[model samples]
Target: METDRKYLFTTRIPVRWGDMDFYGHVNNTVYFRFFEQARVEWIEGEGFRVGPDVPTGAVIINADCTFLLPVNYPATVLVKMYAGQPGRSSVMTWYELYVEGDERLYATGSSKVVWMDTRTGKSVPLPDTLRARFD
Candidate 1:
């Protein structure tokens, strides 16, 4: 990842024993949960509430993760998330996971979320208020 790019949100998550696989390292699938936690926090921090009644928000359309190092239990992971360039109806969200108190990266991930009308399940343009938060 580029050192120059600034992250918009960051949070610490404790690794649970159940998060590990038979190999004793965090499972590959668990990384997406970490990304989801950070993304939800970032969206709420930007003043968007995700609920049944909420009319505007985003739905993840695509997601990916690249593991650089194995993560074990008894560790607190720091996750940093940033909003990339926004398109007409979607925005890219990038994530980086690291061992707490250490700078080295453990994994990197990204997701593309499409803005939509929650009630109708139809795509919508990114709201200016939400887009401005990325700036």
Candidate 2:
């Protein structure tokens, strides 16, 4: 059993020169991508893997975000990820973004991903190994 009551995953992503829009600060779209990297790495860190080999692969069915602060170039922001809920074949990941050296959260959001059979392209049950990691 993955007894990690609070699974915290963090990554320091260097704000790319191109990530900023004309208005400056990392574009709103980039934050979602940052959140995705955190979530994917979180799952990959576990022994469980996500790929075409699995009968079911995950797909983001829903996503939402709130920008509390602006992130600019030459900065490394921390993206935090954690499992929100795990059901039969779906899992929701909660995330928070914090600028380095700051204790305040810059953004918070959650995404719902559902497992689907790659071959059949239909929703399926969550693999036991992956499900076990959830609280």
Candidate 3:
């Protein structure tokens, strides 16, 4: 997979006091939300629909993040995400978080989601509409 694909996304996020846990850093759970928001924003920017296309859908099967550094409050953060290698029914995505002012890397992660037929609850192939949007 091309690691450079992440350069395709641009998402700015404000650091909220509530997002920090007892560790004085953004909680681990919050990273998932940030990644999701970034992906949605990127899709919207590309003019792609996130909902079921012709009554089909996708679900995340696996996701993981590796924290390289802590992100504290009072600083803005930026998250960048991009599609990775496409599979028969799934696509991997890469995500990176960095401090806005200094570009300090805080974390990196990836997620794999599988397209599925909502009615039957079985994996399905990526539709042309969806694939083209990512491509």
Candidate 4:
């Protein structure tokens, strides 16, 4: 479903031959990887580091994907990210994937990310600076 989620960012990733499985198309599991790459790029683009280095970080609580079409190798995938309204400590993110140069949607997905204190592992209010990015 192409929901009207607010667009936030877009990135392009070239499909590798290794992404394909025995069925001769991209494996089902790799779609999450594609969604992840886009999410990471968007996070870093906003000038935040993901791993243990940060005092607070984002953790995805859940993720889901609906595959609509198969993607083959030798293509560059365009992953578009959108955001739902930001909450006190969490937000929902959506993704749309398509082969670059083509408008046809191949997959769509979403994940809920919670901002938490890295050390304590408890949810914390989102940073004001980062919160504006969602607007």
Q: Give the per-residue lDDT digits (tens) of candidate 2, residues 1-135.
A: 123325558888878999999987899999999998887777677655677787657788999999888888878889988775578888777788998888988898878878788899888987787787674
Q: What is the overall TM-score of model 1 with all chains considered together? A: 0.91
Q: Per-residue alpha-carbon lDDT of model 1 for 1-135, expressed as tens digits? A: 444445689999999999999999999999999999998887887788977788888899999999999999889999999777777898788899999978899999988889999878999999899877666
Predicted candidate 3 versus true structure: per-residue lDDT over 23-92, tens digit per residue:
8999998888888888777766766467765356657888889988988998888998878657788888
TM-score per model over all chains: 0.91, 0.86, 0.83, 0.94
Residue-pair clash count for candidate 1: 0
- Per-residue lDDT value at 95 in model 1: 94
RMSD versus native structure for model 1: 1.8
Candidate 3, 6: how far from true, in Å? 6.3
lDDT string for model 4 (21-49, tens) is 99999998999999999998988888889
lDDT of 3 at 126: 79
Cα misplacement distance, residue 42 of candidate 2 (Å): 1.2
Q: Cα RMSD to native, each candidate?
A: 1.8, 3.6, 2.6, 1.4
The best-first sequence of candidates by TM-score reads 4, 1, 2, 3
Instruction: Give the whole-model CA lDDT for all candidates, comma-separated.
Output: 0.88, 0.80, 0.80, 0.91
Winning model by lDDT:
4
Name the 10 consecutive residues with the lowest summed lDDT in model 1.
1-10
Model 2 regions more than 4 Å off? 1-5, 50-54
